[model samples]
Target: MPKSLHPDICDKLRFSKLYEKYAQTLSNILLYKYGDILNPSDKVQEAFIKLWENCTKVKPEAVKTYLYTTANNMMLNEVKHQNVKFKYQQIKPKDYTNESPEFVMRKKEFSNRFEQVLSKLKEEERVAFLMSKVDGKTHKEIAETLGITKKVAEHRIYAAMKYLKNNLEELNKK
Candidate 1:
């Protein structure tokens, strides 16, 4: 893969100027929509890279629309997948009845409890937990990225789970 889009490639048939201008525009749109869920700039960059790879097929005028559409679609899919996972996990959201004081209190309590439990974990265990359970990285991938053996990755993840379970139990009693 080419590390960067070459000036020569961009200069061809005025595609370069269009790509530059619209790339920024597409990135801004993506940032506005998905900045909270994921890295919007990363998604835009990925879309641009895809377009650049197929530059022969893509017209300059169409690049902006295509990039924005592609990034938004990808972000939508991500959100859908997250929703499904959250549902499957059976983690119920706090009940809210139109901005009541009780609802606000419950919401705050949940947030504080979650943070308190998470903060007790060791750094590596916390990272392993988030990567595996939150980001959905497989043990093998986590092991490879963290430069540890697969067994170590598994151990770290299990330890984190045990810690969280115990903490949740302790919280329930209080």
Candidate 2:
């Protein structure tokens, strides 16, 4: 199989014609929407590749709309995510580190609490959370680096936060 035709669906694509007509339209929409942020051309090509991979699943009547929607959604999400990450990175601290006895004691206590809570997490969850928060990566980037879905990356992060919150609260009471 050339991958255009799956066992259940017919291959209705005229590859050159379809590519020529839809490619530029998709690229233009993404570029206009996400300009000066990331490369829309690459994102368009990626969306087309995804479409081609599942060509059999797409009906000829809806392929254009499907491609456009997928590309647009992807680009918009990427743009929003980039903005959030930029804002997060811009947060600066007044002091680089605390050196006083009281500050050092609090830091050690927080570290111990963090380590205790971290030990309770599943190995994969801990690694994903650390890679995302400590190392600083967006969910999509973390997903790509770990070969996992963005949803899974998000879930792991959420679980880690919940665990840390609970553990830290307990530590505070102690």
Candidate 3:
């Protein structure tokens, strides 16, 4: 037996009306069910787009279910990605524990904080600073690699360092 009372949702008029009727409600449901970790509005839009693409295939009755399932999967994929990221980033403590646990904990905290600040830097600044500090590149080398002027490269490195210094002032003092 057919699931929906209405026919297929291929007609543009029917699809538009269906979208208007259910879009906000679906967004609310996704946010409530899945939390705000991912943007529910974007997920809802994607789901609707999928339905529209497969409108000829999906019966009008199943549109709601199809949308929710697609959006839910998308949200779950993002959550899964985050979990995998944390899993790989998980710190493994040394079995010997030569350093005190307190020291290790403090080190990890500082490392995480430093990473946060570093990630917040602008792309140009971060790239210049990393090349200088991590790769031991000179300002001229950085300029050649980035195709920027030496002064611009030096300025980016300085700016990045200033930002890091300001944000990590407490750590620098200690």
RMSD of 1: 13.4
Those runs of model 1 whose alpha carbons end farther than 4 Å from true positions after fitting are: 1-99, 170-174
Tell me the deviation in Å of residue 60 in model 1.
33
For residue 130, give model 2's deviation from the true position in Å: 43
- lDDT of candidates 1 onward, in order: 0.70, 0.71, 0.80
lDDT minimum window of 10 residues, candidate 2: 1-10
Question: In model 2, which regions exceed 4 Å deviation?
Answer: 1-13, 90-174
Please provide TM-scores, in order, for all candidate models, with all chains considered together: 0.42, 0.43, 0.46
13 in model 3: Cα distance from truth in Å?
A: 1.8
lDDT of 1 by residue, 73-145 (tens): 8788777888888877886666656788987888888778877788778877776777788667799977865
Error of 2 at 4 (Å): 16
**Per-residue alpha-carbon lDDT of candidate 3 for residues 6-94, written as tens digits (9 for 90 to 100):** 66888889889988977765675566445566788898999888998998888876777788789989888878887888888976765
Best by TM-score: 3
Model 1 TM-score relative to the real fold: 0.42
lDDT (Cα, 0-100) at 32 in candidate 1: 38
Q: How many residue pairs clash (N, CA or C atoms closer than 3 angstroms) in each of the candidate models, in the order given?
A: 0, 0, 0
